[model samples]
Target chain A: MNARGDTTRKRLIDATTALVREVGYANVRTRSIAVAAGVAEGTLYRHFADKRSLFYAAVLDRNAPIVAATATLPSLAGRGTVLENLLEVIRKLAQLQEDLLPLEQAMIADPTLAPLRGERVQMPLEGPPHDIARYLAAEQSLGRVRAECDPTLAAISLLAMLFGLAVHPLLGNDLAKSELLGASVSYFVDGVGASATQPKLLA
Target chain B: MNARGDTTRKRLIDATTALVREVGYANVRTRSIAVAAGVAEGTLYRHFADKRSLFYAAVLDRNAPIVAATATLPSLAGRGTVLENLLEVIRKLAQLQEDLLPLEQAMIADPTLAPLRGERVQMPLEGPPHDIARYLAAEQSLGRVRAECDPTLAAISLLAMLFGLAVHPLLGNDLAKSELLGASVSYFVDGVGASATQPKLLA
Candidate 1:
């Protein structure tokens, strides 16, 4: 990417994000994006051949915090108490999600965008869940998590806890964010048993 | 308060659900819904009183399975092994979420649908997560799950796990549905720790 190309790409992403915010997800189109970016349709074509490519780049660039967060995850995953490390990653993702609420809705709304599985989607700071899953698996072999525990499920569940809150923030249903998260972490660290491993976080 | 009223309400709900599924979430309208249900606009209002009411009725009715599962959750949240019991409730919700796919997408795409937060969104099951949450709290009091656990977060996490899978199905993500679900459940049961609590499934 040359300087000119880089500038054009950035402009294109900025335009798409703006359009998505101004109107709505389904209303966006290639021509509209190009026009918004103040470039000819052919110019957008030069940078990215189609609307889907443009959309993907726009989404990826718009959510840079996800990328940045994923980048530092491996080190975090390896350090700290395993539970602390996991919660930290979840919190980081939640914060990124809060910052990009519009894109999150757009991603969920567009069925075409659903193919971003672990291997295909490259957010900046992702890829460590796989390594963490493997590490957790090694521990299971040696009896860290329940010997019968599944690491992939653990990774997905952890991610789900964060995403769920991000989706629900003040949207309704009266669960205070901090209080809810405190409970979540406490529950996850130790089971919901009265007689458990750790002391009561809320108490 | 007779058969006529019952039929009218049913027609309105059916019409809304059909419209939501057919034209996508954004294009649905009161007039189109009235036309679909073969009722006059005035007649539609006589039953639903408003568009929001119609929408809520449709969402609630379409999600009968989840509602039913939720209502039944109290039975499972107590006295059993922590992870196993938790997984069973989550699995029940996952099955219920299959019916909620389109409505869930609509909520994401349109802010108008944001009223869902204030609405008492429940599984068709009488008291699924709420009951389960209460039960888990009791179990926490009784020394079943981790004493510090927030059953509320656990409950929400359970729903979101299925939702994440629903958004990206096994077919689309190149994963066998069963295999992915098994892995998902395992990870969820285990915290981000090296090992995790195992789930027990009873009813």
Candidate 2:
């Protein structure tokens, strides 16, 4: 596509995202999306396959930063302190969820989007969990993490913790903002079990 | 008030729950709910205030077991090992989320349910997080938990982990069922950081 086509495509995706966030996925009309993009309805079809494809593109557009950040995680495995590395990952995951969840919840709530759920937008290897698992495995090789711990499970646990934190406020509960991220990381690193005799390896 | 009235109310709530699960909440009609319950439409209003009230009652009815189990958490603090007590709580929470999440997603998707979100159906003290926090605090006082750990924060973390696990499959990801729960609890108790010389305190 030429520069003009690229700009038009970008506009369509941005409009779709805004409209979905504003009126929800179920109510957004393709015609309104074209109007929001300052294009004719026919022009939208020239750039994308359908409204669903446009919405998927919009989701991908919004998720670009997190996907980019996840790609860099494997390289950070042995570079920084494991605690610092995981903390950065947690913060990014939290932010990604914050941006994507409303869109995701809207999709899940719509039954038409059900067929698309089985389709893998991002490969398993490209996911944050996989990248984090790779990072943890590297740390384990360096003896920064426990040798016996399953990196994949740990990665999933960390992902779930961040996901849980994001969803908590949605359920009408308040979390203590001051200590949540740091404290959660600390607890994950040192554990809550009484281990006075154990040397704090991460510390 | 009478046995017949009680039976009718139970049937109405059961029908509402089943209908909400069968049809998405947006698609379910109060009339259909009454029909499913084998009663007249007027009968539903006699037992409950309105359709919203019937839905709320359905949610509460499904949530009763988890609520009942949460009430007993504090008493188990010092009796069994902390690990065993927590595993049971985690299991119950996972089950509660599995049952409640679909109805929750349905409610969140519909705009009509927005007003009810702010209402406190269950008191904060009666929530699983608060109960788990109390259990951890009791264990901390008994020297089973690390003295410096924050019970409330840790409680939230555990709850979040279970919540995260429950929501994972909804997004089309598969979890390793064999090791997930036990490993997560163990990781929470022992910390994933390498403590080569640390005694296995929880073990």
DockQ list for all candidates: 0.26, 0.42
Query: What would the per-residue lDDT of candidate 1 be over residues A1-203, giving only the tens digit for each residue?
Result: 89998998989888877776555566678899888888998999999977767767876775666655655544443344556655666666666565355555556655555554564654422454564566555544433345545676665545555555555423323323465565565445442122234342322
TM-score of 1: 0.70
True-contact fraction per candidate equals: 0.25, 0.47
lDDT per residue for candidate 1 within B64-151, as digits (tens), equals: 7666655654655455565666566666566656555556666665556666545665433234556666756665555455443567
C-alpha RMSD of each candidate structure in angstroms: 6.6, 4.3
State each model's TM-score restricted to chain B.
0.70, 0.80
How would the docking of model 2 be graded? acceptable
Model 2 chain B: worst 10 consecutive residues (lDDT sum): B169-178
